[model samples]
Target: MEISMSTIAFGFIGFKATDFAAWDSLDYISKHRDQGEWTGLYIAEDEATAKGYLSDKINNSGNGIAYLHKVSVIRPGKLITCLDQSFKTGNIDIPALKQAMRDKGINVEDTDKLTEKLGQLGYYFRCFNNEDGAIEMIIPVELVTNVDMQLYKTCIAKSFVFSCQ
Candidate 1:
C-alpha cells in the first residue's frame, strides 16, 4: 500500500465498470474508452486505483459499484506532497518538504495540516494499495468547488487501503 499527501491539477468525469460482466465486456469497455482521453467507463487495474477511483465516484455519484462521477487528475508539479512507496527509502522526505515550505514562509505545521488546508482549496487526497503491498498517497491541488472535507474523511475511513489518520 502507498501513503502520502499531495495536490492534483485536473478532474475527469466518467463511468466506471463494476462487475465481471463489465470487466470482461470488451465491447462495453471499448465504447467507453473511445469517448475521450479520460472519459467513459473503465475497469480499475488494481485495488488501489479502484479505491481511489471509487471514493471519488461515490463522492460524486454516491455509488461504489459501476457509476459515473468526477475524478481528480495529478500531474508532476501539481502534487504538494507525495509519499511514494516505489521511491528508494530516504530519497524523498516529507519533513524536508515541510521545512522547505516553512523556509518559503508557508505556515505548515506538518504534512497533515498542510494537506487539510489544501483539501479545503479544491485539492483531494487519495491513497492506493495493491494486493502486492504497493501503496501510494496523492493529494491533487485541483479546482474542486464546494469542497467536502467530511466526504473525503469518510472516504478515507472506508478505503481498504491505509488510512490517513
Candidate 2:
C-alpha cells in the first residue's frame, strides 16, 4: 500500500498492525492468517478510493482472500471498514505461527497454509453460516506492513481532499 505524505494523512501509524484500531478485522480473513501475524494492516482512512485500493491490493497480492471487506459509511462521514470471510480447515498450531511475517514475507502459499492451520485450531472451523457462529482470532500489529497500509490511506485521503469529483 502507498500514501501521499503531503495529504490529510492520519492513520494507525505503527511498525506493527496490532497497533491499528482495525487490527481485529484480520480475523475475517481467517483467525489463523494472523497466527503468523500476517493479517493486520488492512484498515482504510475514510476514503472510498483508499478502501478500494487496499482491497484490490490484498486480493491481487496472493492473499487469496476468503473474506469480503465491508466499508460502512456513517451519516457523519466516518467509514467503518470490516472484513469477513469463510474458513478452510487445516493445521492451526504450526511452529511457523509463533510470530508475524516480515515485509514481503506473506504469500499465497502461506495464506492457504494458514487456512489449514485455522481448521486444525478449531476456531476457524467453528464459524457457522446462517447461525451466527463466533470466531475468535487475534491480529497483532506485527503482521503486515503498517507503513504501506498507512501510505495508501494517506494518498487516498490527500487525493480526496484535493479532488473536486
TM-score (C-alpha, index-matched) for candidate 2: 0.19
For 77-140, candidate 1 gives per-residue lDDT tens digits of 2333333543335344556655755664555556354454443444333322343544343332
TM-score, one value per model: 0.31, 0.19
Span of 10 residues, lowest total lDDT, candidate 2: 73-82
Candidate 1, superposed: residue stretches over 4 Å from native:
1-48, 51-78, 81-97, 103-105, 120-143, 146-165
Model 1 residue 119 distance off true place after TM-score fit, in angstroms: 3.4
Q: Name the runs in model 2 displaced over 4 angstroms.
A: 1-38, 54-165
**What's the count of clashing pairs in each model shown?**
12, 18
Worst 10-residue lDDT window for candidate 1 reads 145-154
What is candidate 2's lDDT per residue for 1-165, written digit by digit as tens? 210111112233222212123424344445434344233323322233233343332333434222223222111111111122322233233333322221223222443544334233321111111113322222223322212322122211231232212
lDDT of each: 0.36, 0.27
